[model samples]
Target chain A: MMRHWPIFFLTGLLSACGGGGGGGGGSSAPTQICTELNTPQSFTSVPLSAAPSSQPNSAPVTVEAYPTYGNGNFNIPYVTLQVCNGTHCVTVDHVIVDTGSYGLRVRADFPGISTLGLPSINNGSTAPIAECSQFLSGYAWGGVYSATVKIAGEATASPIPIQLTNDPNFPNPPASCTSSGSNIGGLNGLGGNGLLGIGVLIHDTGPYYACSTNGQNGPLNTPLNAILTNPIVSFASDNNGSILVMPSLANYPQGELTASGTLYFGINTQSNNTLNSTYSILPTPATGGNATFFSATLNGQAGPYPASFLDSGSNELFIPPLQPPGTYPLNSNGDYVPQSLQTVSGTATSLSVATDTAPLSFSLLDVTAGVNAGNTAFYDMGTTNSATAGSLDLGMPYFYGHSIVNGINGAQIQFNSTTYTGPFYAIH
Target chain B: MPYRYRWTVVLVGAIVTGTTHATLGGLERDVSHEGQPIAFAAATVHPLPAVPQGVHQQTILNLRSITLTEYSANGTVFAILWSGPTMPDYRSLLGTYFPSYQQVIQTQPLSPGHYRAPVAIHQPNLVLHASGHMGAYQGSMYDPSAVPTGLSITSLGIEP
Candidate 1:
């Protein structure tokens, strides 16, 4: 059956432009945490740990500021999630919460952290160890165990499914289960023990039977989406939602711009954060759909077709090269190619780039209201290339210097800045 | 005892059995375009039906119902076909590779907005192939006129 993949994009939509640059982040406000179901949890106020200090001289690295929901809920700013092993407990900041995927991953270096749970593998009567491959960055392989997560001040007992790496449980790890992108590093560097995929749905995909060349009649296994989970939806109140807000830019080549907003948890907390109107949504193709961006020529061969997507889980922009089909181990000189910007046409004389601190800007308008009013951002060049999707994935880099409001259920995006202020929701 | 055909018995037989009963020997079917065959595969009875003791020969039987099921190696059902005793054989309708495609009757170009397109019914042969191991099925569907067109689906049909 053809599943309705939501389509969101701007095509011959509107000509409205200009940004209402203004409000921003950074206040001495103490961190506050809340969930959809449970009461808010009050903790000793603490400033977020400073982002990693080191910078790659040639390569661009992007570090993003995301929130941890009360344990498993969506990103509610200043929420405390108690991540615990069997013995110890540590509260970590939850940011960049998402609903598009599943599984619970946490940074290994997070304070007050101790144990991890591993999944069980049933081989007839014997239960063996196992691991999972999360195609994006890396894999979260471990035995399953139960851990308690406290969000919005509510406590859930152990018997929770978790991933446990770096343990002596599995003596030999399969090369296929590990990541080929392990060596690559960035702002949201891959040092975390694992990521928490708190998506609404679980199981990577449905079950499948295996027919191997070895003549093994038994089933060849893959990770079922049912195993991994979103902690919030499973929490006492099931706060399974998120908001994403980015300011609009004043056209490309227009120099530095910025916008700020808040990502709230529930729909009722509409005052501060709200969604003005439905904006031009793009079709987020299902994973493995692998739709290639064919320089969809406008008139003649205008050259260079660049595509961008808003992904919160990713902290920085990633650009990959296109390739031909059927070749697994991509040859260095394969057809996969990446192009650079040359010009913005009619608007600018030419588009140029220096390896320094130049930034690109984008526009933001509700799909419903069209592009009337929005904010912009000053984006730092993070990477020159990637091994994944041949297109660029816009992450928190666009939200810097401004308050980003991700309207989960419409009027939930909130931002108050000096130059720009308004219920930016309901622009229509 | 070979009894001669009696007028009374012939009249009774004519009234009770109106439909012709033809024994289908070595049953086979095929799909074609215009009239050329594209691909062909054969199916056979499994385990062979039991032969009664002292039976001198195999009895010729007309195929009443054909239940065709295609599955993955692990027995995952991909397609199932039930011909209501008289339905056309999909194998003979869709050819080897389903070439008979549907074309778009109306063209409404989308401009970056949500749209719900009504489900277009392809020829029944393609539908049968789609119900079976869909892995081999191409996305281009055939319209009533057998013109090929793009199909982006959102949901399955609801039960009546």
Candidate 2:
């Protein structure tokens, strides 16, 4: 592992030098920075749908490997969203499809979205409600508003609560909210236009409490109905769950420039979204802090890791180390540097049934050269998670070549005549 | 008692002390000072079983039931752990270490891809690790030198 350190460090230096020359230029067409890097000749051959399905419940999912707007994004699934205020509507692209969170949060600064005149949600008093949704790396702060959300051919019958992040009206966020972490409420910070949280939970559950502009008052709980909510629950039909299907990139050592997939609404509701009998169903905790996570043991490392979960929002697989820190070469960015291609395995066990377990595995490769060469999608990319050893966050890389189903909490789905109460995950 | 009266006492205490809250590496008494201002419920203090003698834990439950626990021995706090629906105020929890933590976070590279990864800082004296998504978050921070002898920080079961 130590022998691999110099090569990784040198690669970082070269990439840094390559990107340094573009700083002083004026407005111009984005330069292709990675043209000089070594590009792979052979590529993986996997059959993939050229486009998203036209099914009423299906929506196109595009991977913008290298968007001109900001830095290169890998494995970040994006879908176009339409928000309406009565007959007036605005279509916003690059809205991230996040399975780790709940509800739709759009940037209030987006062109037509601000002019839609969506109604603001108030807290009984004259003050409008504001929210601060926290993530592992940062937090999103904004005002909660009601709007009609639509994706593909599915639209909400009535207006539902959504977050308008970076709202100019709510300029001053309380110290309590800002103190959570850095604010990733803008387009560049979010890596997309907005976030579409279609996780297991129906409602965004957290501290509903927020401090208002009126003054420094104690935290007040926003009414459940007024809080930012998952838009999938508001759809008239197919409201139970969703399935994310992506083509396999197992043979793509260098990753693809881009990939396309389909996000189908509702699980086991329509013929196109039915759950297969061969899939394993891992039930997750419906309430408490670990509500969205299940348990897993990775690389034969200890026993059960209670915080394991599948999250499309994360770009890579964050798993516990096969060995302790310092055993593997680590880059300045804290990513593990493998000397050669490596594959690790794990088992995800249902929280309820002891016998219900699913085999999980993925490959890991030193992504420095591939990323420098401008490739965006890599199936064999991951980092060791020393922060929380018990956590195994199988991110977007795990979604490829598989139909990962997320069953909403409290939603009933009929699968082969068997009624399965949701808040679960099934992978085929 | 009325909520207004409770807040008045908290405000007066802060004014007299000249400090808003306590943080990591502060005294055991500072734990209660930090918990009084924003805690949704009263702070709970209990002995940490199966650990070194004289070591105890203080648990504070905030508005969202976000639990922040401080482990202390010899009257000095050595470690702090938090887990719940949302992140706790690091400025209040990490105290003086907050600036260094922020610096590490801001400088950390996000190249190759923009992924929402966890924050892990491993300094010679300080080690902090936080991971989780929205609706659920957990992490632990400790000072290696401050930790009591005969106790390993990893064995504390700090994270959920």
lDDT of model number 2 = 0.67
| Index of the highest-DockQ prediction | 2
Per-residue lDDT over A129-206 for candidate 2, one digit per residue giving the tens place of the 0 to 100 score: 666666765666667788999998888879998887776655444444455455677776677889999987766744
Locate the minimum summed-lDDT window of 10 residues in model 1 chain A: A33-42
Candidate 2 residue-pair clash tally: 0
User: Candidate 1 on B1-160: residue-level lDDT in tens?
Assistant: 1112223432343334433221111111100011111111122111122222221111110121122221111111122222111111222223332233212112222110001111122344333211100000111122122211221111111000
TM-score of chain B of each: 0.17, 0.72
Worst 10 residues of 1 chain B by lDDT: B131-140
Candidate of highest lDDT: 2
Listed models, DockQ each: 0.02, 0.25
Question: Tens-digit lDDT track for model 1 on A1-428?
Answer: 22221121111111111111111111232321100000011112111111221211111112222221111111111223566755666665532243223445454334434344423433222333233322232233333335666554334434354444332343222222221112111113222234444321222221111111222213122223224444543444223233333443334322222234433333223232233333211112121111111111111223132323333443333323322222111234221112222211111010111111112342221111111122122233222222211234334444443333221111112222211111111110
Give DockQ: model 1. 0.02
